[model samples]
Target chain A: MAMKIGEGKFKENVNKNMEDTFMRGAVAGAQERLRTRRLDAAEELGNWEEWRSHGEEIRKHVLDNLDYYLHELAENLQKRGGHVFFAETADEATGYIREVVNANGGKKILKAKSMVTEEISLNQVLEQEGCKVIETDLGEYILQLDEHDPPSHIVAPALHKNKEQIRDVFSDKLDYKMTSKPEELALHARETLRQEFLTADIGITGCNFAIAESGSVGLVTNEGNAGLVSDLPKTQIAVMGMERIVPTFEEFEVLVGLLTRSAVGQKLTSYITALTGPREEGDADGPEEFHLVIVDNGRSKILGTEFQSVLQCIRCAACINVCPVYRHIGGHSYNSIYPGPIGAVLTPLLGGYDDFKDLPYASTLCAACTDACPVKIPLHELLHKHRQVIVEREGRAPISEKLAMKAFGLGAASNPMYAAGSKMAAAMMKPFTKNDRISSGPGPLKAWTEIREFPAPNKERFRDWFKQHEKGGGEQ
Target chain B: MKVTLFITCIVDMFQADVGKATVEVLERLGCDIKFPMGQVCCGQPAYNSGYVEESKDAMKKMITTFENAEIIVTPSGSCATMFKEYQRIFHNDPVWRPRAERLAVKTYELTEFIVHVLGVENIGAKLNGVATYHPSCHMTRLLGVKDAPMTLLQNVEGLRFEPLPNAHNCCGFGGTFSVKMGNISEQMVDEKVDSAEQTGADFLIGADGGCLMNIGGRIERRGKPIRVMHIAEVLNSR
Candidate 1:
């Protein structure tokens, strides 16, 4: 699957998602649950701020010394007989992965859910070569079963789908008679996936953080599917964004703690596995031949830019959970595999403004996402930067908005213009005023009136009132 | 304390009563109030919309307008936050950056000024009603003025305070957003109005005029009995 999931315009996707009451309810419920859990987890830590700061430091340090760490990680991994390919583009990344799959004569590949893999459209590449790639993560597996349904959320791929929906998908595809209880559905999925896990020709997992010092790739998951995906197959490939590297195991531990708490509000997920290279002689588990594909895909462009901090993200959806926009519109509205505030920022950088220009403006600049970010990425600020780029640099903004904003700047900056504008507001709004509120209006007011009543411009401006009140000696 | 009023554009043109209450509240606390007529909008409507270069004109106007005031105060937390933002906005400008810094340090949201600067929790205000507060996102999250609103509200005589469900969420009046993405803003504001209704409160109080207008406008359209109020107006109650 591609990074951009749903077809049509961003607004079209939003309107469609907004109309889906089932999806909206599911998203809101999950947001509340995850939000509370994250808060509780952070509260349990008693020093979440410190932990967050540490996480930010580690990620920032890694990003700053990325080249050194990448070289070191690659050297150490190759020393342990692992193949490391650094792909500066998505096409190159997918090309190398396809070569590995073809070389191994891979079919029926077992995969741990990975946003990077979704980003690079690896599954589509493999499928074109006639490979049946199975999504092992429960959320991803549910989506995969539903005829390649694009994931709505990053961590919880099927977050927009309720249990009943999942059960329906399973019943239609797997033809199983089972209750909608999560346990029952999961058990059935587990039973179905167990054989595929053991017999898959190749195992592919997403790396949470590539440990440079130990040359190990860490996988953090609640499902423990990563362990099985990397262990059961003779050939294994781990894909990671180039920026997802840590200096050593020490920084890795710190980040994993922050990631789990922020994403699921757990102290640590059910399984946190860090594997170093291929299995040695007499090793019980792990692949004999391992390949690491480090995908750049437009990340380096942000390194020295104002958005350098965005690369510090640990893929924790804490920002997504707290976002009011994401709460109302739901994840599918974002259209990218990386949804919510992060998507609004990253998608434009990777996918370009042609498709994602409106993504940045989708936010209210509430800073909830910024506050929720464990690694201290200024998500809201980055979003604002996108807007500036669209208007100032890109010149993609509508001419009407450009004119209106230009007028706003002039009226606001000059005292005479502001006074005339303020003085004329009430008079200009008179025709629309009804009982001190503009129920219907013009221009921007037309949009405002469509949703909510617009307040009639006060006949007496506050400055005029203040002048009179001061003449009355500021009497109450 | 001498206080200069930066009554935000929404208050100046639309919600004058909010500005009035803010002045009265500060005056009763024995602080001298200054109203600089040159003050206009905080450039947020433009700035937040991505017209950063255009927004600087207004930001500079604001900086110059309140340049001489000992301390600046506004009823809107979001506007106050914007005032604070000017420093960072002009961080690289050698000419305006220092001036922006001076203005930011002295600026305060009304509730913040009353509680933090005035050092008074309550001003002997009394309001008998069931009410809840909607903390505007920029106020609580950006400005970090979370406690001041509650501290004063909790001390108000005869006011029954029930927390609004999902109080941390935005009221969906993101200046331009309510207009640009009206559909999404509609959903958000409707949910906010529903949450306030869930509280069964007579009044829904907020610290920002823009948020009040959004929530209040929806409450009006839906014809809910709940009265939308500004925290300044609520605190100004006798």
Candidate 2:
């Protein structure tokens, strides 16, 4: 429910984000860096396409047998003394967590950049119940300090913010005096969060991939905050989307390998901690109680549907990084924690077509996202499918567009109708034509010519000229 | 070699020069070119805009239009991609699926047809200009024709080909999207023009009409002094 962020129509958000030069500049720069790094990392791996295929195979296999893996994961975790809670809805997931918090008198909670927790609005729920939740990841910590500005991207949440903005946020919120240098800002945040990491009663995190064989949850992060989150607190909660499970550590290794390289171009992040159950017998360091909450807010329904491939996503934002639309509009335009190409496809499925219908059409169907997907999600196809549903099944398309398309279908299917239309185009457009182009005109030309000049309809159609050339003995 | 031309709706109505050039280039390559008068739109605009069922009629019409050709060629990579996509579009229809498949295999973008089918690397065309090429999204990524245009472009005797910076990015001409999301498309196309400008190429050469129209239109509107040429026209240049 909380997956949808900000308060506006998609267009309104896009218009606002387009106007944010600071954010646009930051997004464009990050996209280039991340894109280059990802490509370099993929190339260094040698046979990246093969690796992508292997990754896709593992994800597809796991998704196909998700129920079996989920059951195995839960039973194995239970055997290892880990409490497993399967929540069917966002409300149920948060309600169970709130109960867990109240039972343990868990007032201070430190979270380690969990997107599922954000999806469930866990922080606001716990905050209302008097729990002071602190975000430990640097980007997340910055956003938390900035009075909970919703995350624009999944992996790099604060990618929309520049260092100057971070410094401003830190100064305004934390009463810190510091320059906009990244090192200084990071050190300030680390100093601020170290106390919370030690003192918080509960630690929360999102699972990168859960292993069904050993019932271990893998958390990948460069910040080492996830390690601290899973190890420091007495009560540890790992919330995962139901589809984030693999058959074993072997599959886990394959996916996590793709995740890191595709995500931030790291061979192995500073932290790739895999935790199974609570603290075991004679364990040197671990949580006293570990809870794995498997959430299926909308995933189970999509399992057998045409959209099942979407659940194979590892949440690496490589698709976001290469998306030209995402580059222009930035992440916030999506109005979801999951922004960019993946977000455009996944958000509508998780959220419905009502508010999210526009998300599918937001894409140019460029297929960059599909090519960049480590698991080969066919993101552009999925986006097109959403449009099909909107126009064909949902009947949500506008009356004008529907009528226009109806006419298009008639004209396009019949050659005589088309020939007539093309023959009539020049004469009909003559009033609007000047200097061989329609710079500005009426109807559809109005939207197009606003930004670019459209060529006036050719007075002599190509087929007509071809016939003339044919009769003139192939002469130019 | 015989080639039936699916001169797409845009080329037939708007950029007739591209169509004319395609015919000339193919004819020079010893191809007996046939322009099917029955061919119309590729159903991409309606199909991409999400009218799958409504677009099928146009698709079927196209399939039948080019059913008897030895090979199908088009100036636009995007429309060729749409032609290739027809097989999948009619996947569930027993009657049309095979018919669509027959059309899909024989279809080729003009440059692809010139370089691959005709087995000719260059047309020996000469044009005096520094130029850059925009690999339109559907042409490069969807149809998977990455090398043919560049192969042909690299051979043009008098042209200096500078690689477009961030050239792989979409020029934001997603049919109705150009109008539907004009604000965002404006930013995207502007960046594309900026990249093409950065190439210091007087001529911005491209393979797809949709993309060229979008980028070329923007260039012309902004009076950026960059001339946009379709690869067919570029190949036909002397």
lDDT of each: 0.91, 0.90
The TM-score measured for candidate 1 stands at 0.99
C-alpha TM-scores of all predictions? 0.99, 0.99
Poorest stretch of ten by lDDT in candidate 2 chain A: A467-476
Provide interface RMSD per model, one decimal.
0.8, 0.7
**Candidate 2 lDDT tens digits, B89-191:** 8899999999999888999988888778779997899999899989989988999999999899888988998889998899999999999999999999999
- Candidate 1 wrongly placed segments (more than 4 Å): A473-475
Pairs that clash in candidate 1: none
Clashing pairs in 2: none
- Across A145-168, the per-residue lDDT of candidate 2 in tens digits comes to 888888888899998888888888
